[model samples]
Target: MAPMSLQDLVASLPTGETWGPAASEEKTLNGVPYAPFSKGDKLGRMADWTAEGRDKERGGRQQYTRNYRDQIYGAGTQTGFEIQQTEENTFSLVDNTRTTKTRGFGRGGGTVFRGRGQRGAQTQRGGRGTFQRVGGRGGQQGYDSRGGRGGGRGGRRFGWKDYDKPQRNRDASVVAKPDWKLLEEIDFARLMKLNLETSEGEDIDNYGFLYYYDRTFDKQPGAPTSQRKLNIIERAAYNVTTSDDPVIQELAEKDEATIFATDNILSMLMCAPRSVYSWDLVINRQGNKIYIDKRDGSNLDMVTVNENAAEAPMETTESTKDAINSPQALMMEATRINYMFPNQTVVESETSKREMQNPHPFYNPAEESDPPASKSYKYRRFDLSLEKDDEPLHLIVRTELDAVVKNNINGDDQYLTIKALNEFDNKAQGSGGALDWRTKLASQRGAVVATEMKNNSCKLARWTVQSILANADLMKLGFVSRTNPKSPDSHVILGVLGYKPREFAAQMNLNLANGWGIVRTIADICLQKPEGKYVLVKDPNKPVLRLYEVPQSTFEEDGEDMSVARTGDDDDE
Candidate 1:
């Protein structure tokens, strides 16, 4: 009486009281009484009866009733439940003790009829109509002892077969969004030098940003099944002009210029192999044939001359033998090349961050009309060539083009710009699992940058993959993001975009090193650009040791065919 607790007061209340948990009692459904908030007893009995298997000795009508009841209501052994006809042709479950009636399926007790009713059929007829579960959850098509078939008036109910039926092909139509021909016509040499075009057809200028579409499975014809839309990554957008004529400075200050960077670059590198031969070509117009420039590796004097010579014929023979020896592996490699930039441009500057997010720092703002200073650097093309014959099979990347000038340029005036380095050597030397190429490549500053870029690209790629697979819809569908997200670095060396962990490891071990190896030869040439010494890069594909020299003149002569010549004449169009 002093202070009644809630529990005590509830126990003290009368049965008809408004509160106090409503005097817990047996709840009933369809006349079948069950303990309030508990269906365990009823469900257990039903399950036990069904587990005993169907009783075949019962009378024909009784057997039909039992099977039909079990199919419709699942082990129909509810103690106080009775199946009764609520109408002339309709049936219902009635819990007589509880004085309750249920129509369709329910948690406690209910009547569920499968299959539609036929016009001339009734329960009194010669077993013409009987309930048969359709194609639904926990529903299976089965024949009733009394009914003619599984579905009423028919031998069987039509399920998925209706939709699966074949039909005539649809009419021809045009593609909604035409595929852009901009990347197709470019030669590999020029592709390395050209900037991406904006939606309005204006050049993004000086490697501002490249648009990356998810082409993981886009090798086949037609639109890609996944991630077909372009994702623009902004780099140098000082020259980009939108229809609104928005101020470029305002856009930059507002941080509106960049959409994505490291990820985009990583994606491009991942998809570099797709455009290997055509990387250097860009056709600003439709119907223009993609022509190769003099710098084309396939068109090089060494390639042409060597092909005509013993080395060329030997290469063809070796290639055929190699294909025959390992067709699957070689085919995989061919597919991989599409996503890798065998020849990549990695620009370095004194003030730019190691990430190299933007190349604007290398641009001369004072000379608004002039091209960026980075463009003036000779030997713009940095190529990564494979050497399958190497002891462990490695890659050698070098500049395909040479820096030539009429004036004798001293070493101090001209320098070798190591654009980018791809770590293709990643084989484990011993039990420690350390990459032999890592230590080998990190030997020089130039190679260090390339190694860092490669490693960092893997990190970025992993993160992007994680974010994409973490989507709720994707996860619900049982899509595995990665089997090993934290193991051996990405398989960029194999030119394969990393997806599953084990797959990446297998490919990496087969084709690449775990980390990176700074080719001392290439890095040394890149670091010490002194005039007398020539930068030597051995072409792994060719026997020739390509020699590059920096001329005395640091700048190009006016009217000199610059690195990229725009002779389309249809620039305005």
Candidate 2:
């Protein structure tokens, strides 16, 4: 065949062709089923994939006679190479030969629980909780490219290894897991409370029990216990002056937990703030009105709760109470808190959005502004940077912290800066804020999300959940799975992206290469077996090879089976 133009070559192109070398640079051609061109992914030359380059045509229809001896067919011919490396540089990844070392989750060697070890030291009993560990290696600052926050062995961080391009090797992908609280994994009741109560049911006003004589909590709430879990509440904020009656003032300042538990009305008067909230009932100081802040140029409201109420933790809410009395209000606030908790009852609340954490969007700070922490320890948080995908997809990456390193100078200031999210569990005790933040993150299609500056860097870890969960295809293809209950599996979240993968994910395992799959060893790929065995779904052109890596199971220990199916044990040879 004569030398063909790019257009002619693409025109003659067979289906399932991987356009490349210069294809990504071409942007778009007349009409071709071309893969989304990414300069990062390796793409070989288009011409080399043709029958003109090799003998026997590589297994009938299989492309890429990737063999080097066929660089030129016969003599006096031009070199046909798919991958072009200019005089500049090229990157390649080399894997560790020790395949036996790769085990799933806890049983895997050389893998360490990077955040958990740090938490044990900070706590009273010297630490037994793995989820509570904070910070990464290299001082308390894990973000620094240097030492202290990474590498259990104290060398450079070890990640996907590379050959040739040293710069690309240094470009390590740090996959941080979500900081899953030890609380209820699925929150089945809460899920029912929101969906059935709000989405499918009538707007049942004032359904939850109103406490007139309940008591507030005293000890810290770490995990979910029948008696220990915090309750979400709707309350009224009040302002009492020098001329006011003692009865109202006492009730206004009292803690919800104290009033509900002990019913000691005089000692602890729990005021009812007609605000939509969860966890703590925010008591806005009397005379406080709706006001706007310059941030984001959006109308914002602060509780302006009495400095005395600062003794009790208060959260902020973004739910608006306007026109709840009107039918249009129902349509306007469909997906947000309005679905369940609507209307901040106070009439003035219509002017501004109520400020308190509840159901979906909630935030309970480690320490209140002017008040000391209710407990002895200071607040800790994490900061991270995520690679922005073109679209939101379900994604989950779990890396056990090698060990946690912590330093608490005083009760007011504590530092636990580390890798991943679970470590931030103890300090960031607001599951409400986490759920809200996750929703916000999922809204951003493709954005590199990072937490604000704080000692601990990986608080909530909800963004990680959003990343993997939204990308249903990737998650179903065995790319991500939850390491904890808060992350049970991608099933529910993937449903958000309109995907169901219960069957496919269950069928294949990376441990067995008999079926069609992708890069088995980061090396060879088998498109189709000669005898016509199994094929990969949605990827008819590409072969799916089995991977031999099986994660270690906590199932037997948890009284649950591996659930991961065993491959038929087909031999590659």
Candidate 3:
């Protein structure tokens, strides 16, 4: 090929290769130091891509939306009043059937008088003194139903009428949890079930059980009455805390066999939404606790988790020969996880593999692992399944503040929207028969964002919805370590902490286990650096992505691995 003259170059140039003289430069979000756009970012550069109901949204053939946020699929515009009215009507029917029985038992001479002292023999009236007895008298037959509204000295049992509007105000309080009822029934019930498992356990397990209480429900203003405490997921057989620390904590750990590149990235993102805007985690000084809420301000309950939540295998661990997996999903194995506090780090191991003389029927982990060393129980789980098996592009993010967790008018709508994506999405199918079950289960919990095709040569481009709870700190309950061990991908978690699971796990010598582990409140966030390049990530606080600290990134760069040049922070050992 010969070089052409400047005049000849213009003549042979391809069409639509350049902007015309009339084209004026428009500011983009890609400029350095400061991003041109934020939460409500708007721009002509990517407007069409950002528009609703469009393909090329995060490389999908469908539109990107908080699809679950609408009435058709979302929480809908339904009110708690409607639920209450329904509940009341149902309760009324039940009340009618049992009103005479329940109210009478509380009021009349039967159990009431028996408690009052058997009409002068020996019992204290233990109920609120409000009864009306009008039967069994005149001494015609002394064997008649001999009892009066006896406990008329006990306190009045407060009913719905007793609660007033002023008493339900959250004006002076902080909503640490969401109304569990407002969430999808299955999701809420699952959380409650986990709470019960822990609470009902003996020994040190209760604290682990109690740790998930904050996630149990949203604690609405009045509808589904709740104790006005820091709204826990489940109450213990005793509302007991062995330590004065107030909140109880637990943890689960495992190392993914992160030998390859793809596995590494997927492992990181699955932990939580790695978006910069999502870094705002909740830190409550009073409870000495923290919670991760999506941008919409609701708890990130880790519903992707299953029974034995910390023992599930992840894609990376199972896909690799030397992989380690979390033991969350295998019910065959019994596992438990907990933490060594103050230091807030982790250590994991296996327990007895032999069965006892008599076994209490449950998913027994002990008897299954013949030699304990032969144990292998981890089922991989993915929160989102794709229509296409191709790789899903993810953008990590980081933020400066941790958002608060609570319930409010705006927060409720946001919760419904998120649930529509999370809980409902998993159950929704775009088109199908029972075979499309997986397709319909369409849950997505990230926020929608956009990107371009290239620097200058572009039409409408790609977009995505990122998650606010990436790299979360999780506390998985029901992890029984005595039998089943944890896998590398932990499904049960207290919730997410803002830190990469890989780097943080390494620092703690972490190995995913069926039992508990706590990552001493680590915090940070991830996000794309310099925009459209979509390759670089920056965490001002975390050094994992810092060029200076990780001189040679362990992550794959094209065909090369950055591991050789990788180093911890120079400031660190």
- Model 1 alpha-carbon miss at residue 360, Å: 9.8
Please tell me which predicted candidate would have the highest lDDT against the true structure. Answer: 1
Tens digit per residue, CA lDDT, model 2, 1-573: 688898887888888787556444434457554557555444444475555534453334242333232443332233454344356546642322222243322222333443311322221111111113333334331222321234444322222231231320111011111321121121111111211000111111110111110111111112112112111223321222211323323323542111111111100111111111111111111221100001110011111111111011122223522323111221122212211111111122223322212111111234333321111111111111124524221101111111111123442312111111111111222211122223332454122122211111211111122222122221110011122334221111110111122222232110111110111111111111121111111111111111121122211233222121111001100
Residue 43 lDDT in candidate 3: 24
Each candidate's TM vs. the true structure? 0.19, 0.16, 0.16
- Model 1 stretches with alpha carbons more than 4 Å out: 1-505, 508-515, 525-545, 554-557, 561-573
Q: After superposition, how far is residue 301 of candidate 1 from its true place, in Å?
A: 23
Model 3 ranges with Cα > 4 A deviation: 1-267, 271-351, 354-536, 539-567
Residue-by-residue lDDT tens digits, candidate 1, 1-573: 499899998889888668447544566787677645443322424333432232443335465454444333334444533243467656554532221243322222233334322112112111111212233222443333223344543233333352353432211111111221111121123222323211111112222212212223223212123212211122221211111122322333443322111211222222221111111211011111111112111111110111111001121134454331121222232222212221121222334312113343334567565333222111111122234323221111111110111114442222111111222223311111113332332234334323332333332222222222111011000001111223212332211121332233343221121111212223223333332322222222221223344232211233332322221111111
Model 3 lDDT vs. the true structure?
0.20
The candidate 2 region of ten consecutive residues with least summed lDDT is 564-573
- Candidate 2: RMSD to truth: 29.9
lDDT of 2 at 505: 26
Query: Candidate 2 has what TM-score?
Result: 0.16
